[model samples]
Target: MIFSNHVLLRESLHAVLSTELDVTSVGGDDGEALTAAHKIRPDVIVVDLDGPGRHGLRTVRLLVAELPECAVVALTGRHTPHALRQALAAGARGFASREQPPAELVDLIRRVGRGERMIHPGTALATLAAMNNPLSARERDVLRLAARGMPSAAIAAELFLSEGTIRNYLSSVVRKLNCRNRLEAARLAEEAGWI
Candidate 1:
């Protein structure tokens, strides 16, 4: 099973999977994918994790929660350590970047379908390095709100915190993650599996 939002990538991926002579490509987003899953209950779902519209992490979470037997493999263009962690935390069984060769991707899909967990070798070390760098529960809440691109004042209003307090929390998150900017901090949090 494959769930993707882009036509070109979907077609290309389908072509790659079809070469196996057994794998079928059922591609779409959260709703369509869920419908297909309900009907076919595929053993594995290869999901594209690019672009902004699709909440890849949330999709993976839903799939894992709804279809416990199904395995998810995330395919991404930006295989940052943060995104890697988010996918895994959302119950992804495999993670591969678009930069990887097609042959390796096919192999990963097959392996994941057989109940194996896979990660891009390049990201493995960064992921390991991030293991002990967990954000506190409050920090996680702040970050989640920040992910929506909310301003400090808005986040403060929603979370019932002062603007200065929100800024303090954001600063703390950046320091803890060793990130120079809030964006980088958020990315690290995502990669570290905090989201």
Candidate 2:
């Protein structure tokens, strides 16, 4: 199955893959993909990871949790290490750049369907560089909320922690990133695709 918000990309992949395998194209949010995936129960799901608001990664995670038997292949234009790491962390079994030839993507889908994990060579290099992410999971959570302009108190409420704890997390993040303030830390993390 092919899931992407871009109609052209979705249709193109479907047309190409349907020649040798059954294909289903789903458009919209992660929820839509999950629904169709449950009904179709496809062997593999190709998701566009560059979707707005990181919906593609969310979809990958949801599909992996709900349909562990179905392999997921993430396609993205942004081949950054952080993107690759995020997709893998979200449970994607395969990763490929959108710029890759269609034939390569088709082969990746086939391989993943057979339960083999794969990553494009170019993306693999990025993953190697991504090994150095310094923030803890909790720190990332706090920074992510802060990046959205949430005050420390608001972030604390959302994360069910005290405001002082939220402030401490923010301080740690700033110091770890060597930034002058939380705002700068958030900006740096966002630019590096760390959050």
Candidate 3:
């Protein structure tokens, strides 16, 4: 199965992968993907992880939790080590860049289906750096929005979190990064490519 918000990419992958494997379903949203995954019970699920709002990572996590037997392969446009680490932490068995050829993705899917875990070589250094990242996913989200110049109230509204909660997260981020303020923490996270 293939999951991506981009219709063209999903259809293209389905077209190519269906030739060699049983492409059970192609989904463009989390609800559809989860439903199809449950019904089809595909052996391998390829998820595009670079989607807006990091919904792909959430889907990967849910799929892993709900369908423990299914192997997940994270397909990302960003080859950053942080991206690879995030996918792996979410329970993906394989990580591949979208820049890779279709055949390579197919091979990765096959390998992951066979229970062999792998990460893209391009993320080797990034992966090492990402290990030192002290922020949690929610902290990253808050810091990312903060980095974008959003005020705490706006960030809270955008994230559907309380203002106090947003402030707490920001404070936690500052403390974790050992920065004097949220702005400095955001700058540091941005420089480190953690947000």
Candidate 3 lDDT over 127-166, as tens digits, reads 6676688999999999999988999999999999999999
Q: lDDT for model 3, please.
A: 0.86
> Which prediction has more favorable TM-score, 1 or 3?
1
TM-scores for every predicted model: 0.68, 0.68, 0.67
Q: Rank the candidates by TM-score, best first.
A: 1, 2, 3
Write the residue-wise lDDT of candidate 1 on 37-107 in tens digits.
88988888888888447677777888899998999999898666777867898999999887888788888
Candidate 1 displacement at residue 144 in angstroms: 10
Q: C-alpha displacement of 179 in model 1, angstroms?
A: 8.6
Q: Compared with the true structure, what per-residue lDDT tens digits does model 2 show for residues 14-124?
A: 898898788999999888999999999999999998766658988999999999999999999987766777889999999988888878888888999999999987878
Candidate 2 accuracy as lDDT: 0.89
